[model samples]
Target: MLAVNYTTLRENMKTYMDKITDDYETVIVTRKDNKNVVMLSEEAYNNIMENIHVLGNKSNYDWLMESKAQLENGMASAHELSEAETDE
Candidate 1:
């Protein structure tokens, strides 16, 4: 995470934007009156939204927890994928 004032961010917009996209960094742009904004890559934003959607659903969250518990308890099985499946 990086924090910079609005003037500094504007001065080096390309540098900061490149860093954010290349390194998957989150940047906070500070402003007056306690108004601030965050900058992140589109890929990062999508991943965050996807996680929120998955975890926000009660049934999906419960299913994931159950799967995790089964894996932790060694109740999971492993199977090799066939070549046809892998091709897809």
Candidate 2:
């Protein structure tokens, strides 16, 4: 994540665009009136939206919470990823 003033971002829009797209970074543009905004890669935005969709559902949220509880209580198994599997 990178923070930049609105004026600075306005002056170097292309540079910031390249950073956000090529580097997959999130940019925080600060406003004078404190209305800050974020600029993220399209893939990042899509992933966030998908997560919101999943967590917004009652059943999905309940299942996720249950899974988290199980993991925290030592009821879940952790596995090490092999090199081939890690590539994905």
Candidate 3:
């Protein structure tokens, strides 16, 4: 992790961002007025958000596959679709 003041960020934004993404796992830019105000590495931030989505899904691929297998075996619950047959 790298800790840089916001002023330093304003002065060399691109170089700092590039260095963090290419070589460091994290970078923080602190503000003088706010002790902890900062900027985080865009790549690492994005990766963290993506994992949240994946982990938050309660019933994912394995559950879907089990449901499919049950349906194929005629063991899943059902309601007659007589309306669709009547429409035909």
Candidate 4:
């Protein structure tokens, strides 16, 4: 994560954008008067949206938590995905 003032960001927009895209770093751009905004790579944004989609649903949240508990309790084991799925 990185924080940069809006002025600095404007002055070095390309550098900041490069860092965000290549390094997958989240940036907080602070404006005057305490206003702020965030910048993230498309991949990061999609991943976050996907997680929100799953965790935002009640049944999905419950199932995920239950599976996590089972794994922690030694009731579940991890397995490799099939080649076809991994190709994605």
Candidate 5:
């Protein structure tokens, strides 16, 4: 995460934006009167939203937890993909 004041961010907008997109970094643009806003790449934002949607569902979350526990307990098996499946 990076933080810069509003005026500073405005002065170097391109550089900051490039850093955010290229490095997948988040920035906080601070303003007067505690009006702060965050900046992030669209890809990052979409990934976050996707995670929220997946984790927010009770059934999905439970299934994920169960899978994790199974893996931790060595109750999972590994299978090799066939040539056709790998091609897909």
Candidate 6:
């Protein structure tokens, strides 16, 4: 990990470019106050995005977790919701 101020990044853009190699992961550019931008390689970006699926649906999450555990233990059972009647 490298912390570089925006001015330094702007001044040494070429040096920063040269520093990027296959071994390097990311280059973070920040202000003196530590506000920053993340620079990542395409392969790194793709790998990060690929693992983003771990962040799944927030709704019904607790239900899912409990049901998942139950299913794994062969104790899961389903209850069908009653259908609502519609009048014309």
lDDT of 5: 0.97
Estimate, for each residue in 1-88, the C-alpha lDDT of model 1 and write its tens digit. 9999999999999999999999999999999998999999999999999999999999999999999999999999989987655554
Among residues 3 or more apart in sequence or in different chains, the pairs in candidate 4 whose N, CA or C atoms overlap within 3 Å are none
Q: TM-score of model 2 relative to the true fold?
A: 0.68
Error (Å) of candidate 6 at residue 59 is 16
* lDDT (CA) per prediction: 0.97, 0.95, 0.74, 0.94, 0.97, 0.73
For model 6, which pairs clash? none
The residue ranges of model 4 lying beyond 4 angstroms of the native Cα positions read 78-88
Worst lDDT 10-window in candidate 5: 79-88
| TM-scores for the candidates | 0.87, 0.68, 0.50, 0.83, 0.90, 0.49
**What does candidate 2's lDDT look like per residue over 6-67, in tens digits?**
99999999999999999998999999789999999898899999999999999999999999
Q: Give one digit per residue, the lDDT tens place, for model 4 in 1-88.
A: 9999999999999999999999999999998888899999999999999999999999999999999999899997678887655554
The list of candidate 6 runs beyond 4 A from truth reads 54-88
Give a tens-digit lDDT track for model 5, residues 1-88.
9999999999999999999999998999999999999999999999999999999999999999999999999999989987654554
> Which candidate ranks first by TM-score, i.e. highest?
5
lDDT of 2: 0.95
**lDDT per residue as tens, model 3, 2-44:** 8878888789989887887778546677766777654556777
Give the CA lDDT, 0 to 100, for residue 11 in model 6: 95
Q: Which stretches of candidate 3 lie over 4 Å from their true place?
A: 60-88
Clash count, candidate 6: 0
What residue runs in model 5 are displaced by over 4 Å at the alpha carbon?
A: 85-88
Local error of candidate 6 at 34, Å? 4.0
